[model samples]
Target: MIWLLLLLSAILGAIAFVAGRRLATRRAVGQSAHSRPGYHGAYAMIWALAPALLVVIVLLVFGGPVKNTMMESGSPAAVSALEPFEREAFLADAERVAAGAEPLQIWEGELAPALRSEGARAHRIESTISGAGVLAVVLLGLLGGLIALSRLRPNLRARNRVEGWIFGLLFACAAVAIITTIGIIASLAWDSFRFFQAVPIAEFLFGTQWSPQIAIRADQVGSSGAFGAVPLFAGTFLIMLIAMAVAAPIGLMSAIYLSEYAGSLTRAVVKPVLEVLAGVPTVVYGFFAALTVGPTLRVAFNDLGALLAGGPLDGIGQYLMLVQNQMALTAGGVMGIMLIPFVSSLSDDILNAVPQSLRDGSYAMGATQSETIARVLMPAALPGVAGALLLAVSRAIGETMIVTMAAGLAANLTLNPLDTVTTVTVQIVTLLTGDQEFDSAKTLSAFGLGLTLFAATLVLNIVAQRIVKAYREQYD
Candidate 1:
C-alpha cells in the first residue's frame, strides 16, 4: 500500500510538472520570464511530491502507534487482565493472527476467542487506515499542485527556490550525521556512568587487574569482578606499538620508493598488489598469524633457547623458549601486515601531492633524489603523513578479530609481546558475548571500556590534528 501511494504521488507530480511547464510557456509567450519553463515545472513537481511525501512519512512514523492504540482500546478483558509482559505477548499474537499467521504460543482463560475478535478488528482497522492514508496523499498532492500552478508566473524565481531546497537537503544530511555521533556518545557515557556508580573510577582507571566476572546470584561463588582496566590498556598499546613499529617504517619506505623512484609500469603493478593487502580479510591474517607465524616464531626461539641453555645467556634463552602461539606479537605483526596498504596508499598520495616545484628546486640545487625526498618533499607532506599514520593507529586500536584469533584473551599487564594479552576491544566482545542482564556491572562495563576507548581515540585524533595544524600552518 505504501509503495502504491508513492507511485501515485510520482504520477501526480509528473502531471503537475507538465501542466506547470505548459502554463509558464503560455504566460511567457510575449513577455520576459524570470526563470525557465523547466524551472517552473520542477517547482510544481517539488510542491506535488514534497507534500505527498511528508504525508507518507507521517503515516509511516505514526501509523503503527495509532493502530496499536486502537487495538489496546478495543482489547478483550482477558488480554487487559494479563500481566504487562503477557499482555504485550497477547497483543503480538493477535497482530500475528490478524496477518493470517498462527499464534506462537497457546493461550488460556478464554483468550482464544478474544484473540480472534481482536485479530479481525485489527485487520479492519489496518484496512481503514491504509485507505484513509491513500486518500490523504491524493488530496494533499492535488491541493499542493493547484496552489503551485496558481502561484506560477513569469516573475516567480523558481530556480532559486529549487536551489534553496537542495541546499536545505544537504544541510539536513550533515545535521543528521552530527546528531547521530552525539547520540552515540551520550548513550555510551550514560551507561558508563551507571557502571562507574557500581565500580570505583579510581580502581578502574589505576588498578592493575582487569578480571570482570561478576557473580550472577547473591549466593554464587564469584570473584567480585575487578574492573581495573590498566591491563587492557597495556595490552592495547603493546599490540598497537608493535604493529606501528612494523608498519610505519616499511609502509613509509614502500610509499617513498613507489612514489619517487618506481617507473609507471612498476608503480601500476606494485601499488595495486600492495593495496590488495588492504582488501584481504582480517580473519585470514588471524589464521596466518595463528597457524604459521606464531608456531614458527615459537619453534625458532625454542631451538635457539636449547642452543643457549646452560650457557652465559641462560635467562634470555628460557624467556625466548616461553613464547606462546597466542601472543601480542603475533596479532600485532599480522595487523601491521593488514595496515600496510592504508599507510602506503595515503603516504603515496600525500607525497605525490607535494608541488613538483619543490623537486625541481632541489634538482636545481644539485640535490639527489634521496636528499630531495628526505629534506624537501617529506617535510611538506608531514602533516598528511601524520594524519594517515594516526588513522592507521585508530584502525589498529579498534581491531577485534585479529586480536581475538591471534592474541589469547588473557588480560596480562606485562609489556612482553610474546606473552598472551587481550585488548579492550577483545574484552568488550567477551563481556557482551552471551545472554546476560544489562544492569549488572559485568555487562555495563562493556560501555565503560567502549567509552574509555572512545576517549583515547578522540584524544589521539585531537593531538594528531593539532600536530597537523601546527606543521601545516608553516607550509600554508
Candidate 2:
C-alpha cells in the first residue's frame, strides 16, 4: 500500500507539473519565480520524493539495532538457550498471535504459555511500529510534494535547488561505497591487531618458519607450530615472478599483435577466444596447474635437454631434474597463461586509444610501422600499459587457488624457482579453512595475513593510478 501511494504521488505530481508548464506565459504571470514552471514542477517532484526516501533510509539503518535492543532488553535468558530452529519457531508463533490470529497449534503443544504469550506480544509491537512508519512516510511524501507545488512561483529558483540536491545525492551515494570499503578494511585490521597481540609482530614478520597450528587439547600435544610468515612471503613472490615472466611477454605481445598487426577478422575471432580463458573457473585452472601443467613441464624440460643432446646428453638430464616439481617455474608458468588475456586486453585498449594523429605524423615522416610503434606509440601508451601490468601483478599476488593446488604447502625459504615455497594467501586459507575458535592465534593469524595482503595491493594500486595519470598527461 505504501509503494502504491508513492507511485500515485509521483504520477500526480508529474501531471501537475506538466499542467503548470502549459499554463505558464511570458507576460500574463505577475511575477516569475526562481525558475521557470517546468523546473518548479521538478522541484516539487524532488521535494515529494526526498522526505519519504530519507525516512525509509533512516528506518532501514536503525531497524536491526532497534529490534535487537528491544529483544535484548526484554530478557536474554528467555531466548539464550533456544536453538536456532526453536527460536525461529517461537518468533513465528508470536507473529500470528500479535496479528490477532489464533496461536499456532505447535506452540501450545511444545512451548510454555508464558513464553509464547510474551513472544506474541513482542511480535505485535514490532510489526505495528514498522507498518505505521511506512504508512507515515508515504503520506508525508504526498503532503510534501503538494506543499512544494503550491509554493512554486515564477520567482523561485527550483531548477538550481533541484540540481544542487541531485549532486548532493550523488555525492552521498558515492560516499556510501567508499565508507563500505573502509569498514571492511577496518574490521580486518582490528582482527589482525588482536592476532598481533597474541603472537609477537616481529616473529610473524621476520621468522622464516610458518606453522599456524594450535593445540586442540591440553593433554594432546607437546608443542604447537610456529607462526613465522617469512616462507609464505617468499613462496608468493617466487610464484608471482614466474607468472609475470610468462604473462608480461605473452600478454603484451598478444596486445601488440591485436592492436597493430592482426587483421579485423583475425582479431574478431581471436580476442573472444582468448577472453574465454578468463571465464574458465579458477578451480579448473588449479586442477590443470596441479595435474596437467606441472607434470607436462617436468617432462618437457627433460625432453628439450635430451633433444639437444640425443647422441650424448651429458648434462641435459641433470639440468632437467633441477627444474622439476613444486618449483616456482611451474606455478608461475601456469599463472602467466591464466593472466595473459587480462594483460593483453587492457594493453590493447590503451594502445588503440593512442591518438591516430600521432600515427599519421609518424607515417608522413616515412617511418616504418615498427619504428613508429616502438618510438611513438609505445611511449604514448606506456602509462596505460604500465597500469595494466600493475593490475596483472595485483591479480597474481592475490591469486589463491592455483598456488594452493600446485605450490607445495611447505613454506621453503629457498628463492630458487625449482624449490617449493608457500604464499601469504595460501597460508591464510590453510589457517582458517577449518572450524576455529575466534580468539585462537591460529585463526586470528589469517587476519594478519589479510592485512598484509591488503596493504600490498593498496600500494600497488596507488602506484598504478599515479603512472596512469602521468601517461594521460603525455597526450594532453
Candidate 3:
C-alpha cells in the first residue's frame, strides 16, 4: 500500500510537470521569460509530490499506535478476559489471521469464534486505514498541483525555489550525520562512566586479570570477579604487532613491485589477484585460520617438540610441545593476509602519485633503478605509505570476527605467539553476548572497551592525517 501511494504520487507529479511546462510556454510565447520551461515544470512537480509524501510519512509514524487503539477498543470479551501475558500474543495471532495466516496459538470453544470475529475486525480496520491513506494521497497531490499551477508566471523564480530546496536537503543530511556521531559518543561516554564508577580506572588500565562475571549472592562461586584489563590490552597489542610484522614489509614490497617493476600486463593480472584477498570475507579467513592454519601449526610444532624433547634443546622443546591450535600466531597471520590489499592498494596509488619528473631526474643523475627508488621515490611517498599502514593498524584493532574465531578467548597477558590470547574486541563481544543487565559491571565493561577502542582508532587516524599533511606540504 505504501509503495502504491508513492507510485501514484510520482505519476501525479509527472502530470503536473507536463501541465506546468505547457502553461509556462504558452504564457511566455510573446515575452522574455524569467524562468525556463523546465524550471517551471520542476516547481509544479515539487509542489505536487510534497503533500503526498508528507501523508505517507505521517501514516508511517503514527499508524501503529492508532491501529492498536482501534483494536483494543473493539476487542471481544474473550480477548478482554485473556491474561496480560497471553493477550499480546493472541492479539498478534489475530492480526496474522486477518492477513490470511494461521493463528499461532490454539483457542477453544467460544474463544475460537471470538478469535475469528476479531480477525475480521482487524481486517476491516486495516482496509479503512489503507483506503483512507490512498484517498488522502491522491486528493492532496491534486490540490497542491493545482495551487502550484495557478501561481506559475513568467517572473516567478521557480528555479530559485527548487535550488533552495536542494540546499536545505543537503544541509539536513550533514546535520543528521553530525547528530548521529554526537549521540554515539554521548552514549558510550555515559555507559563507560557508569562502568568506571563500579570498577576503578587504574585497576582496569593497569591490573592484569580479566574475569567479568559477578554472582548474585556473596556465597556464589565467583562473587568478586577479577576486572583487570591489562591482559586484554597486552593481547590486543601483541596480535596487532605480529599482524603488522607480517603485513607491513610484504604489503609495501608488493605495492612497490606492482607500481615500479610490473609491466602493464603483469599489473592488470597480479594486482587484481592480490586484491582478491580483500574481497574474501573475514569470516572465511577466520575459518581458514581456525580449521587449516591453526591445526597445521600445532601439529608441526608438537611433532618437532616430541622429536627434540630429549635433545640439548629440551627446555625449548617442552615449550613447543605445549603449542595449541588456538594461538595468537594463527590469528595474527590470518589477519595480516586480510590487511594486505588495504596496504598495497593505498600505497600503490600514493607511490604512483609521486611526480614522474622525480624518477626522470634520478635516472638522469646516473642513479640505478634500485637506488632511485630507495633514495627518491620511497622518501617522496613516505607520508602516504605511513598513513596507509596506520589505517591498516586501525583495521587490525577493530577486527572482531576473525579474532574471535581464530584466537581463543583467554585474556592471557603473555606475549608468546604460541600461547592463546584474546583482544579488546573479542572480549567486548564476549561481555555483551546474550541477555545481560546494563547495571552489572560485566555488561557495562563492553562500553568501556568500546570507548577505549574508539579513542585508540581516533588517535591513529589523527596521526595518519598529520603525516599526509606533512607530505603534502613537502611536495606542494
Per-residue lDDT of model 2, residues 1-476, tens digit only: 34544565566556556644544434227774566667766777777777776666666687667765665456345554578777656666665666677656464333566455666667756776577667767677777776776766666667788799889989999999999999999999999999989889998889877766655776543156578888888888889988999999999999999999999999999999998988888888889888888888778876776666544665765676556556677777889989998999999998999989999999999999999999999898898899889989999999988887777788788788766777888888888787778888878999999999998999998998888777665453
TM-score of each: 0.90, 0.78, 0.94
Off by over 4 Å in 2: 1-38, 64-89, 92-127, 215-225, 294-330, 416-420, 462-476
- The deviation in Å at residue 414 for candidate 2 is 3.1
* Candidate 2 weakest ten by summed lDDT: 19-28
Cα error of candidate 2 at position 50, Å: 1.8
Q: Which candidate should be chosen as best, given TM-score against the real structure?
A: 3
Name the candidate that leads on lDDT.
Answer: 1
* Ranking of candidates on TM-score, top first: 3, 1, 2
Better of 1 and 3 by TM-score: 3
